[model samples]
Target: MKRWWATVPEIAEDVRDALAAGDDIHAIRMLMDGINALPAAQKAGTLDDALNAPDTTGDPRWDALLAGALRYRLHQIGEHAPSWTFKEPLEKGWWPFAYSPSDAYNDMAHTPAELMRLGIFLDEREFTQA
Candidate 1:
């Protein structure tokens, strides 16, 4: 499978393509599946690269969401995230998806540790689901 962030060219293409297509979810799914397909030893490093990849998509909100999602993924695997993942500003917002108040309540109620720390409220299923 192709990597979503294997090189500067690839990251630029993938990130910009998704923005042009108005499909942040597809971009994130590409990221999730890309990481999921990697060997255990490679997953964290690839995720870190994806996290650090420049935001060519011109969507800082999406960039922040990527940070939140990748950090959460790292935590799920018991890996320490790249320290930069936390140091940068959160870019101001909640999870970048729409949900009902009840859904927000539920996510808040069952907070996943790392995302909670990042102040991103999302169901882990956002990444955990196939």
Candidate 2:
């Protein structure tokens, strides 16, 4: 299933670069802008698609990032509880949700390259701009 983040590679790269530069705020802002810039129909459809897609990818990192991105997006829309106050069921032995536990820990674990890969994977490759 295509995800909202998967549809915007350039924006994802920008966010990853910002994260590498130790500017998480900028990364989050870029993410927010990218989502907001999408047409309303696309945004709604993509969000639903991502949420309903089965967790076929067994990689914990991918799972964590995908879940985090979804949560972050929800937070932006004022749908998620305050400060990302939600706990997803854990796959036994998997690291706790990256964003939770602690901000510092989340940053340490989710490196720029990891985020870049997640972004690339999420991109649906359905449309191109020229």
Candidate 3:
């Protein structure tokens, strides 16, 4: 929970709202950008590093699973091993990242990394159905 963007409640709420509003892709992007913009104290670069890295061999354990999932999806689509990176701007979320710390203290909190993983979950449910 102490990872870079894990403590941001506003981002979480926004993602929830976006999901409720039928805007899942928008929600995912908002979460990504919000985490990217956080200050150094609360920011964790693990996801961003793995996403932007030239090679994924250096990715941390947590990110490796999701990153592998992403790579697999890309391969299924006939793409290269590493697909183009995507991140939504903060405006896509309902609230700004500036208010996330306070929201984390008093409300549900989640990091961009958490939300992105949610994206993978939805994708799997929607696309991998038997």
lDDT for each of the candidates? 0.57, 0.42, 0.38
Query: TM-scores, in order shown?
Result: 0.64, 0.33, 0.29
In angstroms, give how far residue 36 of model 1 lies from its true place: 3.1
- Model 2 agreement with the true structure over 22-100: per-residue lDDT tens digits: 7755655665555454444244665443234322223444344444454554554555422322334433323322445
Name every residue pair that clashes in candidate 1: none
Greater-TM-score candidate between 1 and 2? 1
| lDDT score, candidate 1 | 0.57
- Give the per-residue lDDT digits (tens) of candidate 3, residues 64-125: 32343344444444444434333232222332222456754332243333233323222232
Cα lDDT for residue 34, candidate 3? 46
How high a TM-score does candidate 3 get?
0.29
> 34-54, model 1: which lDDT tens digit per residue?
444433436545544444455
